[model samples]
Every structure is written in structure tokens, then in C-alpha cells.
Target: MNVITDNLGMLGQGLVTTLTIAFIGYACALVVGTVIAIFRVSPIPPLRALGAAWVTVACNIPTLCLMILAAFAAPRAGVPLSLFAAAVTAIVFSASGFVCETVRSGINSVSKGQIEAARALGMPFGLIIGAVVLPQALARTIQPLVNIFISCLIGSSLAAAIGVPELTNVTQQLNLRYAQAVITFLTSGLTYLAIAFLATKLGGLLERRITGREAHA
Candidate 1:
């Protein structure tokens, strides 16, 4: 209790950093992933190739290495970003590939009859995608999106490596400074678990809303 009380402020600060990284990463991933997924299904061979290459290469790379590269290598090469910014870039870049795959899978999961019907109705490709396909895909992908978010939340811990002072980093500092190793680590773990669980519940609600809308449409 003493240790928790003493480190409450620091924990609050760390929580803010964690939320910042996750939200930023999620927004970037959503956009980039959707674009790449569209490209992956493009009629143009080159577009498909480019999308596949990005996903393949990024998915193969380790998240920590990517974060370090974003923080250190890019800077040394004169494209400098602060630790926080680098973390945002790293998480987004890495997570985007996964999101792309998820989006693609969802797109594929939809029935061909709907797309064919849309095309027969003279809907443009963009309209078909935006109006008919995307809505359905988003409905199907909500649960997976939530799962990806939970993973992103955990991966944000790597931000500590770049001196971002996210949850794990702050906990490490508290552990060393207060010599309450067990308490600090346990508290951090519980907090992370709690957030993940809460997110899962919220995601379920979102999934219901999205799917209900799709059914009505």
C-alpha cells in the first residue's frame, strides 16, 4: 500500500504515456492498414505487389528492432524524431501490416454475391468499397480490431526502451528507487491486465453496434 501510494503520481503519468502511444498507434494503423488492404486487393499487379511486400517485410521484422530503428537509426540518418514520436511511428508502422492482413481477411470473408450485386447495380469500385464492402468488413472485423488493440497496448511497453517513460519504464524506475521490486512489478502487471480486460469488454459492445448497423443496412 505504501509503495502504491508513493508511486501513484508516477503511475498516472505513465498511464497517460501508455494511452497516448496506443491511441496514436491505433489511428495510424487504421488508416495505413485500410489503404494497404485496398492495395493488396487492387486490380493492378504492381499495387498488389507493393502491398504484399510491405506486409511481408514488416511482419517479419521484430517490433523492438523497428522501434529502435525509428528512434535511433532514423535520427542518425538525419530524420530525427523524439522518443515519443518515434514510438508512435514504430508502433503504427509495425501494427499497420497486421491490421492490413486483418482487414484483407475480413474483406475476403464477405460473400461474393454482395459485391457482384453492387457491381451489377453499376456502383463504382470506390463506392462499392466505401458503401457496401467497407461497412460489412468493419462489422466483421470489429472483434479482431479489438484484439489488435490489446496487442498494441502491450507492445507499447517497448516504448520504455526509447526512454518514453510509458508504464513499464516508470515501473522500473519506481522499483529501483523505492527498492520495492515485487510491489512495483506486480502493480504494473495488474494495471495492464485490467486495461486489457476492460478493452475487451468495450470491444464487444462496439462489435454489437457495428454488426447491428450492418444487418439493418
Candidate 2:
């Protein structure tokens, strides 16, 4: 209690920063993942190859290495970016690989018959995918998508490695100043638990809502 009370402000600020980075990173992931997923499923050979290569390389690379490259190496290459932006960009790109696979799985889960039926009606590829396929795919994939979001949320703590001053970084600094490892770590752990619990609840609620909407449609 004493440790928490003493550092409540710093903790709150860190929490805000964490949430901000997570949301922005996740948003970027969603867009990039959707595009890559589309490419993976496209009839074009080059598009599919590009998508596959991206996911394979991005997923194989460690997030820490990505962060280091984004923060340090990029600057040496004349593409300088701030630490916070670089960290978020690395997280976005890394997380998008998983997200792309998740979305592609969802796209595959849609019945082939429906897609064929759409094509028989003279529907353009874009319209068939966008209007007929994607909605059901997204509805079916909500839980997995939410799970990815949560993973990305937790992974944002890695920003501490790049001096982003997010939750884990702030907690580490506080631990150093207080010299009370048990109290500091316990408090930080509880904070993460609470955040994760809330994310799970929210994800469940969203899944239910999307399912219900699909049923009505």
C-alpha cells in the first residue's frame, strides 16, 4: 500500500502511455494485417508470395531485435524516428504478422460454397470478398482477433527496452528508487492482472455483440 500510494501518479501516467501505445499499435496491425490477409488469399501469385514472405520473416524475428532496429538502426540509415514512435512501429509490424495469419484463417473459415455462389451472380472479386466473405469471416474470428489484441497489449511492455517509459519501465525505475523488489513487482503484477482481466471481459462482450449481429443478418 505504501509503495503503491507513493508512486500512484507515476503508475497512472505509465498506464496511460501503455494504453496509448497498445491501441495505436493494434490499430496499425489491424489495417496492415487485413491487407496482408487479402494478399495471402488473392489469386495473384506474386501477392501471395509477398504476403507469405512478410509473415514468415516478421514472425521469425524477435520483437526485441525489431525494436532495436527501429530505434537505432533506422536512424543510422537516415530514417530517424523518436523512441516512442519507433517502439510502436516495431510492435505494429511484429504483431501484424500474427494478426495476418489470424485473419487469413478467418477468411478460410468462410464456406467455399458461399464464395462460389457470389461469383456465379457476377459479383466482382472485390465486392464478393468485401461484402459477402469478410463480414462472416470477421464475425467468426472475433475471439481470435481479440486474443491477438490482448497479446499485443501485453507485449507493449517490451517498449521498456527502448526507454518508452511505459508501465514496465516506470515500474522498473520505481523499484530502483524504492529498493523494494517485492512490493514494486507485486504492485506492477496486480496492475497488469487488472488490465488483462478488463481486456478479456471487453473482448467477450465484443464477441457476443458481433455474433448477435451476424445472427440477425
Candidate 3:
């Protein structure tokens, strides 16, 4: 209690940073992932190859290594990038790979007949995908997407490595300053638990809404 009481302002700031990183990273991931997923399923061979290669390479590299490379290597090579930006980039790229795969799977689950019907209606590829396919794919994929979001939330803790003032970093600093290791760790863990619980509940609500909409559609 004293640990939190003494550092309430700092902890609040850290929480805000964590949320910022998580949300911004996820938003970036959503866009990049959706694009990659489309490319992965495109009829064009080169696009499919490019998308597959991206997913393979990004998925193979660990998020921490990506963050390190973005933060350290890119700067050394004349690209000026901040640690916070680099950390978020790492989260985006890594999480986007998983999101790409998940979205692709959802797209694949769409019935071939529906796609053929859309084509028969003289729909362009983009309209078919956007209007006839993406909605259904996303509806079917809400749970997996939410799961990925939860993973991204947990991964934001790695921002501490880049000196980002996110939750884990602040907790570690506070613990060092106060020498209350047990209390500090417990508080941090509980905070994370609360965030995770909220994410799960939110995911459930989203899933229900999407499912209902799809059913009506």
C-alpha cells in the first residue's frame, strides 16, 4: 500500500504508457497484418511470396531482438529512431505476423461459394474481399484477434529494455528505490492481472457483438 501510495503519480504515468504502447502497436499490427493477409491470399505469385516471406522472417525473429535491432542497429545505420518508437515497431512487426496468419486462416474459412457468388455479381476483387469476405472473416476471427491483443499487452512489458517508462520499468525503478521487492512485484503482477482480465472481458463483448451482427447479416 505504501509502495503504491508513495509512487501513485509515477505508476499512473507508467500505466498510461503501457496502454499507449499496447494500443498503438495493435493498431499498427491490425493494418499491416490485414494487408499481409490479403497479399498472402492474392492470386499474384510475387505478392504471395512477399507476404509469406515477411510472415516467416518476422515470426522467426523474437520480439526482443527486433526491438534491439530497431533501437540500436537502425540508429547506427543513420536512421534516427527513438526507443519508444522502436519498441512499438518491434511489437507491431512481431504481433502483425501472428495477426497475418490468424486473419489468413479466417479468410480461408470463408466458403468458396460465397466468393464465386460475389464474382458472378461482377464484383471486383477488392469489393469482394472488403464487402463479401472481410466482414465474415473478421467475425469468425474475433476470439483469436482478441487473444493476440492480450499477447501484445503482455509483450509491451518488454519496452522496459529500451528504457521506455512503461509499467514493468517503473515497477522495477520503484522497487529499487524503496527496497520493497515483494510488495513491488506483487503489485505489478496484480496490476497485470487486472489488465488481462479487462482485456478478456472486452474481447468477449466484441466477439458477441460481431457474432450477432454476422448472424443478422
Candidate 4:
């Protein structure tokens, strides 16, 4: 209580930084993952292969390794990044693989008959995908995407290792300063748990609303 009360402002800033990293990272991951998913489903063999290779590499590498590479190696490779950018980049790179797979699964769940009908109507590949596939696929993917967002949020803690001073980093600092590791860590854990719970509940509500609308339509 003393530690928390004394450092409320610092904790608040840390929370904000954590949320910023998570949201930015997840948003970038969503865009990149969706593009890769499109590539995986593309008629062109090369695109599919490229998508496959990306998923294979990204999924196989550990997030911490990616963080190190982005934070340390990239600079040596002439691509410098701030700590925040490196953290977000690592999250985007690692999480995009799962996002791609999740979106690909959603795309596969779309009715084949509808796709066939669109093709029969002489719709171009892009048009058919944009009009007849993506909407339905994305709709089906809301819950899974929400889960990915939650994972991204939790994973942002790893940014602390790279000195981004996010929630976990601040908690560690407070623990050292106060010599109250248990209470400080517990407080941080509860904060994460609360955020995750709220996100889950909101995701469920959104899923239900979307499902109801689709049913009525």
C-alpha cells in the first residue's frame, strides 16, 4: 500500500506505456498478418510460398530473440530503432505469425459455395476476396483476434527486458526501491489480470452482438 500510494503517478505512466505498446503492436500485427493471410490464400504460388516462409520463421523464433534482434542487431544492420519501436516491432513480428494463422483459419471457414458463386459471376480475384470473402472471414475472426490482442497485451511485459519502462519494468523498480517484492509483484499481477478480464468480457459482448446481427440478417 505504501509503495503503491507513494508511486501512483509512476505506475500510471507505466500502465499507459504498456497499453500504448500493446495497442500499437497488435494493430501493426493485425495489418501485417492479414496481408500475409491474403498471400497464403493467393492463387500465385510464389505469394503462398512467401507467406508460408514468413509464418514458419516468425512462429519458430522466440519473442525475446526477436526483441534482441530488433533492439540490438537491427541497429548494426543500419536500421536503428528506439526502445519503444523495438519493443513494438518485436511484438508485431512475433505475434503476426499467430495472427496470420488465425486469420487464415477464418478465411478457410468461409463457405466454398459462396466463393464459387462469386467466381461464376466473373468476379476478379481481388473483387471476390474483398466483397465475398473478407467480411465474412473477419466477422468469424473477431473472438480469435480479441484473444490475440489479449496475448499481445500480456506479452508487452517482455518490453521491460529491453528497458522500455512499461508496467513490469516499473513494478520491478518499485519492488527494488521498497524492498517489497511480493506485494509489488502481486499488485502488478492483479492489474494485468483486471485488464485481461475486462478485455475478455468486452470481446464476448462484441461477439454476441455480431452473432445476433448475422443471425437476423
Candidate 5:
């Protein structure tokens, strides 16, 4: 009530920061994850092993622990990062593991018969993957990737642990100042819900458009 009215600017800034971190993290994760997924599916055994190792390590470690290490230990090891960078880095690293797995699953979902047909037609590996496999695989993966994006958005709140001043952190600060924990936290919670709702709706729309195009093609 009064708490929110009095701190509209603060909440707004926090929301912006949250969105910035989440979007950047998700974008980086998508790229890195795709690369890792390729590696997992590579003809080279070493590349597959490397991708497996990455997924195992990244997925095993907790995201918060990764953030703490990035924020604290990295500086001690002579790789200094601002709080924001550390937060984004941790989010990207953690989210990429899940993204990699999701994409690999999508890759696996591609029709083996189609791959065999392409090979029978003498298509090069790169051409087959680029022209035939990836488009279909990516199309099938839209919903899972969208779910990952939403997870990344929610996970961005963990940045508050390292003083990133995102929505959760701002809510904590306001709560301390105003002593209105319920109202302050509820406001932040509702904001997160609203953003997630919008993201899901947009994702559904995009999925439908892509599906329609695929059907037509």
C-alpha cells in the first residue's frame, strides 16, 4: 500500500535490473547450450565426452554455489567480476547445462529415417545437419527452451545473494526499511508472476506460429 506507493521508482528499477540479468543470461545460455548440445552429438568421441563432462559438472553444482564462487573466489584467483557480471555468469553456466540437455533431447527426437535418407542421398554431415536436422529439431524444442527461459528468469532472483540489487534484493531492502514484509514480498512475487505469465503467453504464440509454418511447408 503505502510502502509500494512510496517506492515505485525503486521497485521499477529493480524489475528492470531483474529483466536485464535474466534476458542476458538466457541468451548466453542458449548459445553455449546449443554448442554443448552439438558436442554431445558430435562424431568425435572426445567432443561427446567433453559435452557430457560439462553437463555433469554444471548440473551437479548448485547455482547459488556457483554464484558465490564467481563473486568471491574468482576475484581471489585474479579474475575480478562485478556483482552483475558474476550473477549473469553463474546463471548462464547453470542454465546452459539444462539447456544443453533439452537441446540434445530435441536432437535425438529427429527422425532417424530422415537422417538415413539424407545420408543415402550423399548429403555431407554439415549440410544434413544444417538443412535437415537442426530446423526440425529446433522446432520441436521451442516449448522446452521457453520453459528453460522461464526457469532462468526465476533463478535470476538468486542474484540477490551476491548483492545484485534485483527485484528480490530490493524487496528485502524495502522490507527492512518499511517493516512491511508481507506487502513488500507480495508485491515482488506478483511482479514476477506477471512477467512469467507474459513470457509463457508470448512463447505459446511463437510456438504456434512456427508450428503453422512447419505444417504449411
Candidate 6:
């Protein structure tokens, strides 16, 4: 605490970087996950297989290893990214797999009758998916998405490994300077808890709103 005071501003700057990386990663993951989930449930065999393979590869890899591989290997392979982009990209690829699986379950929970009715009404494939399937799947996916978001929030701490200067990394700097690992970690934990709470509550509220609308309609 005492030893860290002079560097608190620097630490705050690092915290912002952490949040930015996490947000970018999660946003990208959300898009990738949605695409994967859609493909996983598609009628096309190759698309489904591709989605499955991606999930297996991404999900099975360790976080730090993925970060390192993405950060370092990419340059070696010729398609290079900065440390921050690499960390964010790795997080997106990894997190998207779990989110894809969770969303597939949500898609499954959408009743078959909805699809049948949509087809019977002459709704085109795209229309059926856009109008009927997605709404229901999204409603169900909300809770799980909230859960996924919370996990991402915690996992973002790992960005430190790639020199991203995220909250955990900044926390480490503070701990090193002040020799107050316990206090620094506790503060970081509380900040994460607050983010988790907000995510859960807001997602739940949105979920309920849509569900309520569906019920009334």
C-alpha cells in the first residue's frame, strides 16, 4: 500500500489497458462463438465438422500456452501481431469455443416445433433462422453468456503473461513494489467480483425482458 502510492497512477493506466483487452477479446469471442454455434447446428456436414474441430483445438489448449503461441508463433510464421492483439486474439479463440458449446445447448433448447412452423409458413431458411430460431436461442443463451462473460473476466488476468499490462499484471507490479501481495490481490479480486455481478444482473435482466415479451406475445 505505502510503497505503491507513487505508482498508483501507472497502475490505473494498466488497469484500463486490461479492461480494453478483455472487452475486445470478449466482443470478438461473442461474434466467433455465435458463428460457431450456428455452424455447429447447421445442416451442412463440413461446416459442422469445422466448428467441432475449432472448439476442440481452441478449448483444449492451455491459456498461457495459447497466448505464447499466438504472440510468438505468429511472427515466426509470418502473420505477426503485437503483444496486446495477440493476447486478445488468443483469448477470443479460446473463449469462443466454450461459448459456442453453451450457445449450441441454448439453440437445442429452442423447440423443434418453432422450426417446423417456420418452415411450414414458407419462411426461407435465412428468415427462419433470423426470425424464429435466433430469438429463442438468444433468450436461452443469455444466462450462459453471462456466465461465459464472468469466466472471461477472470481469465483476462492471464493477459499478464503476454505483457498486456492488464489488471493482474499491474497487480503484480504493485505487489513487487510494495511487497503487499495480499492487499493488492484482494483489491483486484473485489474489482472482478463487481464486474461479475454487473454482468450477471444485466444479462439476467435482458433475458427476462425478452422472455417476458415472448410470453406475452
On TM-score, the leading prediction is 4
lDDT per residue (tens digit) for residues 61-147 in model 4: 988889889999999999999989999999998889999999999899999999999999999999988888888888898888988
The CA lDDT at 206 in model 6 is 95
Candidate 1 on 117-155: residue-level lDDT in tens? 999999988888889877778778988888888878998
Model 3: number of backbone collisions: 0
TM-score of 2: 0.95
List of clashing residue pairs for candidate 1? none
Lowest-sum lDDT 10-residue window in model 2 = 143-152
Which stretches of candidate 3 lie above 4 Å from their native place?
A: none
lDDT of 2 by residue, 71-186 (tens): 99999999999999888898889989998998898899999999999999999988988998887877777778877778777888888999999988998998888787788778
TM of each candidate vs. truth = 0.95, 0.95, 0.96, 0.98, 0.96, 0.93
Instruction: Output candidate 2 Cα RMSD.
Output: 1.3
For all candidates in order, the CA lDDT equals 0.89, 0.87, 0.91, 0.92, 0.92, 0.84
Tens digits of per-residue lDDT for model 3, 64-155: 89999999999999998899999899999999999999999999999999999999999998898999888888888888898888888889
Model 4 Cα RMSD, 1 decimal:
0.8
Compared with the true structure, the alpha-carbon lDDT of candidate 6 equals 0.84
- Note each model's CA RMSD in angstroms: 1.4, 1.3, 1.1, 0.8, 1.2, 1.6
* True-vs-predicted CA distance for residue 67, candidate 5, Å: 0.5
lDDT of 5 by residue, 119-185 (tens): 9999987788778887888788888898888888898999999999999999999999989999999
Backbone collision tally, model 6: 0
Off by over 4 Å in 1: 212-217
lDDT preference between candidates 3 and 5, better one: 5
- lDDT (C-alpha) at residue 151 in model 2: 75
